[model samples]
Target: MGLLSVRNRFIEKLRNFATLSDPAEAALEAATRNASKLPARRDLIREGDRPGPVFVVLDGWACRYKILPNGGRQILAYLMPGDCCDLHIGLLAEMDHGIQTITPAQVATISGGEMDSLLTDHRGFARAMYITQLVDEGTMRAWITSMGRRTSKERASHLLCELYLRARNIGLTDGIELVLPLSQIMLADSLGMTPVHLNRVLKELRLSGTIQLRRGSVAIVDPARLAQIAGFDENYLHRRLRPAIAG
Candidate 1:
């Protein structure tokens, strides 16, 4: 795609919260111009790393995770295309979690100076960023609720539903199907379950005809039924504005 079209795509994401003015578009273009194509499994930021540039996922999947003292890892959230990571993290000295790509991705890095410019001169863009941050916080809250209250089957189904809805919103889905690049181990880590247990859960879902997984793709056969099983409420994702999914 052309540069203007690429910039417009990023602006479309911000427009989910507020209508963008020409100046806001220009500011986004300035920030988005420095994207680098990163390989899959690359760490964008690491725990205790001094915070610097903010990252925007222009394409592919990435996630935020924390490592426990026992070397166990918990995936906190997934970052999708049009999602910006840590919009205000530069204010902090270091990151408590790290961000890594699950697939080869085009990641745009906006420096502290550019971010300051957006806040100082582009008020609309700044407001959109604030909305995005609020949505992220809401997603985290929902994830915590799922872990504390939902069963393993419910947790996995809920995650699948959330991701499917999000991918659809971003035009990444073909009908009810989308690429689910997560491995069983990664899904288990995100759900706080053992890999073996996760396998059983997937088998059950498949046997019941609730979903299908093949060649790194996921198809929700009956989303309504699956959502019912998980007791999932999309409201927590803030779908009225920019809808996002949790990991």
Candidate 2:
């Protein structure tokens, strides 16, 4: 894709939090103009590496994860198109977790100097970026809740629901169909279940007419039903901006 298109995607995600001024938009466009493409299953950054330029996913999917000494991996979060891996990670001395691409991905790197200027000179952009971080934290909390309290079926359903909505928000969905690009192994790892157990849960969902899974894709046959089974509430995503209330 062209640079303009990439900038538009980032702006689209930021608009979910705050309105951007002309300069803010221009700054982002310039910062993200140069992008590099990486093949699927490539590691963008690894644990213990020194923090460098903040990486943004301009296209395809990436993930935040940590691997245990036992060779087990735990996926912490999914990074969709337009999602930045870490906007303010410059303060950290080293990466605590690794980031890897789930598909052939286009990524942009914003230097610490440019990031500082964007945050210092652009109030609207800074506010939007801060809120974006807040939403990321909220998403992590939701994932924790899913792992600790939800059953296997509920976890699968909830993840599907969340990915569908997120894809829809970023205009990646065609109606209720989403191009998930995720393998069963990746999904199983994200949901904290064995591949066999996740396959069973997906079978149950398909049998119940909640969703239909195709190669690297999913069609939500009954969105409301799927959400109901997952007991999902989109409030945690904070897609809509609410006015500040007076104290």
Candidate 3:
């Protein structure tokens, strides 16, 4: 399929995630016009570089993150379909983080010049993109609290719960049975714990029958129990319930 076709399909998927007014849709279509697609594992954009064109994840998942001196990585965010990977660039003094693929993905690049043009022409587009930035900031604050205050067990479960919420927003999860791609070691880095410690906590969660992870798939055996263990809360995502969509 062509870039426009991919964009149209992504737009359809996004309607389930957020209310994109018609003008917003037009603005997005403009940015996507004459775009190029990227295969998975390609560095669509990197940290510490001038903000280039925004990337639309036509399919699959990507992560935005930063690496510490010892090579530890903190995944700041995951971008799914209907989400813009560099929408926050306009607000940043410089790029301080990097993005990479987690799953096989098809991506479309929209030039910064076109984004600037759309901001002037598409009021709703500007509003939606700005809202995306605000949403990211709020989630970052939650991560700070989770990593700093929550227990290692809480930290992992919280991340799982959070991904569940995000995956739902992207119409990927059905409110449960979400898949987390990162291994236990990756989980440790994001939660600021040693891999050994993270593995220990995972064992505890599994033994308690609150959750289970096998073959890279996570099954919430007892969501309420799991929530209790990790102090998971849906409020952090700030997403509209799927059932709330209008007829």
In lDDT terms, which candidate is top?
A: 2
Stretches of candidate 3 exceeding 4 Å from the true structure: 1-23, 33-40, 88-94, 241-247
lDDT assessment of candidate 1: 0.84
lDDT of 2 by residue, 85-123 (tens): 788788999999999998888888999988988999887
| TM-score list, all predictions | 0.93, 0.94, 0.82
Q: On a 0 to 100 scale, what is the lDDT of residue 75 in model 2?
A: 93
Give one digit per residue, the lDDT tens place, for model 3 in 1-247. Answer: 2334444545654454456667767666655554445655666667777777677777667778787888777877777766667654656766888888766666677767777876666554555556566666878888998978988888888877777767766656775577666777667767888899988988888899887888667877788887787777676565653422221
lDDT winner between candidates 1 and 3: 1
Q: Candidate 1, residues 143-241: lDDT per residue as tens digits?
A: 998899999999999999999988887778769777888899999999999999999999999999999989798889999999999998988767686
User: What C-alpha lDDT does candidate 3 achieve relative to the native structure?
Assistant: 0.69
Candidate 3 TM-score to native = 0.82
Model 2 steric clash total = 0
* Clash-forming residue pairs, model 3: none
